[model samples]
Target: MELSQKRFVTIICTYIRAVNGVYGGAAHDAHVWSLSNERQYMPSNYQNGDKSSWLIGDSGYPLEPWLLAPYRNAEENSLESLHNEKFTKAKSIIERVFGILKSRFRLQYAPKKVVKILNVCCALHNICLIYNVEAPTVIEINEERSNLALPNVDQNEFSRIAQTIRDRIKISLRS
Candidate 1:
């Protein structure tokens, strides 16, 4: 029997920062570990081309596209629209990460032993990835989603802003 290739897995916990709330004893502390990733990535950031870790988001925090406009490349048309869409899509990773974190590891609710449990679960998540180990969990998942509401971004306004961002990015990229 031939052995298959072994793959390594990294446990990533995504969380959002509570800008005005107290979490784990620090105000606006990087409360959500890998959780904050929702607002982190943009679509254009991932080209499936370069190993661009600068924008790869293994760093601290991803800047908002509006503010990150200055760093965009100029040669591409419709870049602003593309980048905005990319950012929105990138945020989805955070959601999926969180969903798995909560459903699989039972990380929901603020428990007194949160950090402790998280450490153990994160380790397990990583381990299972490498061994192709099956994470057999007893918790039965419900079919209904609770929070599926949409954001309040007006489509017309968003298009206008997106266009402006593209223009600005072009100017910045050219300079």
Candidate 2:
């Protein structure tokens, strides 16, 4: 799902599975879906090094030429620290969007027909956004599930290219 930081709106959503699904299951791995689905239509501008249009995501997301993720590990006062701070601030907007979803739709305990219900909720959310309806003041809380083991993504040519892009981004941030 995509969220607009400026508008507090859900920009795009693709249902994979319920929150109860296995952490590393095909439906739950963000990187897998991203590679197969969203990566296909990445714009030529981003591919040609236009950072302005890139997507920013958390560590759970794979670092790609068109996606920016915070540094995984960094020393105090390091460039990575500054990058991570900025990245986290930007990502927090999505976190609030999720909270709004849970509050307005009770997504955590959504009953049978999970995907269908979630999709409907997302559509309704967008409608509410369009109408400028006030979001529920009481945001629901959902604990994050445990981290899953890394999936066996192949370290092939694309991975190498993505890594190179990430390295350049890190260096640029440092400078």
Candidate 3:
């Protein structure tokens, strides 16, 4: 019997800063472990009892009051499924942003070049989006390359709060 190749995974999280109530800058991904352990990127409203504000994340992230994820085992035509649909639509915006970034910058494929060139590319990317500039046609990058397994994280107080909020969203979607 032959052994198959073993693969390693790295998690990337994007940080978007708000200025004048408008989102600015291109998205940047931090390694998952760092995001799991750090608090610097957390928004002020997250800790100030602002229940209305939340982020849409995938199953890779733990449920938190400020982060909504799709429900496990959501059945077809159910409220959970509907919630997941809306959540996915919101998530697709991020996906499209990355697709545009990679399509415009060839250097993005090289890991060492990413940090040095990413900021500039992201700034240009935002500019393109603002002016509705058409991106040059290029070979499509594989979007599923980073489809890694979810990281292991213990459920905590924030996760419970996030789940509670997800439930509320589902209920609202039902009616």
Count clashing residue pairs per candidate. 11, 0, 2
Cα error, residue 98 of model 1, in Å, equals 1.4
Mind giving the per-residue lDDT tens digits that candidate 3 earns over 1-175? 0000001112122322211101111222223322332333444567765667666555645456665667767999998899988877776655555455557776535444454555666667667767889876764433332233433324466766667788887899866
Query: 38-99 in candidate 2: lDDT tens per residue?
Result: 45555465667664456665565555556655566678888678767766666665666666
**Candidate 2 deviant stretches above 4 angstroms:** 1-26, 43-51, 108-112, 141-175
- Candidate 2: give the clashing pairs: none
**Tens-digit lDDT track for model 1 on 98-153?**
44545667655454456445556655665666677754455343222212222233
Q: Kindly report which residue pairs in candidate 3 clash with one another.
A: 64-162, 65-162
What candidate 3 gets wrong by more than 4 Å, as runs, is 1-39, 136-155
C-alpha lDDT of residue 55 in model 3:
60
Candidate 3's error at 175, in angstroms? 2.6
Model 2, position 146, has a per-residue lDDT of: 21
lDDT of each: 0.36, 0.53, 0.51
TM-scores for all candidates? 0.40, 0.64, 0.67
Deviation (Å) of 87 in candidate 1:
2.1
Which runs of model 1 end up more than 4 angstroms from their true locations? 1-26, 29-51, 55-78, 133-175
